[model samples]
Target: MVAIDPEPLLAAGRLAHEQLMNDACTITRVGPPTLTRGTSVLTPGASTTLYSGACRVKPQRIPRNEQASERLTVVARYEVALPFSSVATDDLQVGDTVTITASGDTRLVGQKFAVMAVDFGSHSTAWRLTVEGAT
Candidate 1:
C-alpha cells in the first residue's frame, strides 16, 4: 500500500477558495486607546485598519415586523467570509465595523455592519463573521 501526500490537494482547495473571495471588505478596529489627554482622561480611540482583502459577503434575512403600528425597518445583516490568513480571531471584536464596497462604486456601498459574532473555523480554514447594521 502507498500513502499519497495531501499537500497538493490542500493547496488547490486554498487557491479555489481565494478565487471566490473577489469582493473587497475592510475590517476596522475602533477600540484601542490612542492618547491620554489628562491625568484621568483618555482620548477616544481611532479607527485602525485591521484587515483589507477579498471576501464573500451575503445579505442575511431581514426581520419582519409583527405589528402595524411598529415602524418596519430593514436591519441589514450580512455573513462575511474571508481567508483565515487575512485576519486573526483576536483582531476583531463585537463592535468592529466592516465596510464593503462593490465594483468600485460608492453608491452601491452597503451599510456599515457591526460585528455580532465571529466564527473562526477550526484549523484556521476560514473566518465567518456575522454582522448587522450599526444603529
Candidate 2:
C-alpha cells in the first residue's frame, strides 16, 4: 500500500484554502433528480417502490480570505459530484479540473473549472464542488 505523510497533506490542504481566495470562482448549480438505481422484490404477493433524489450539477466555492486558516471557519462547502449518483466516499485532490456543460439559452456554452476544495468526496466527484476557476 502507498503511504503519505501527514505533514504534507495538511500543508496542501491549507494551501488550497489560501489559493482559493486569490482567483477563485464560487458557483452554485442546481440540477433535477433522476433515477439512479432500482431494485425489486416480492414478498407474499405485494410490491413496493422506493425513490432517491440526487443533485445533477457541480457547485464551487472559494475561500473569501487569502489568509484563511484551515480551522473550519476558514473553509466553505461545495457540491462537486454528479447528483445522479450516490454518496461520495473519497477525498478531493489537488490540481483536478472538471468541465461543465451548461444547458440553457445563455451565452455560457463550454466552461471548465479547477477543483480546489472537494472537502468531502473523491476528487472532483461529489454532490458539490469548491473550484477556483473562471466561469
> Using TM-score as the measure, which candidate wins?
1
Best by lDDT: 1
lDDT of 2 by residue, 6-79 (tens): 76565565455433322222233223334434544333322221112222332345545344365433433344
Each model's C-alpha lDDT? 0.71, 0.39
Cα lDDT over the full model 1: 0.71
Candidate 2's C-alpha runs over 4 A off are 1-81, 84-92, 121-126
The C-alpha RMSD of each candidate to the native structure, in angstroms, is 4.4, 17.7
TM-score per candidate, in order?
0.68, 0.32
Against the true structure, candidate 2 reaches a TM-score of: 0.32
Backbone clash pairs in model 1 (N, Cα, C under 3 Å; residues 3+ apart or in different chains), count: 0
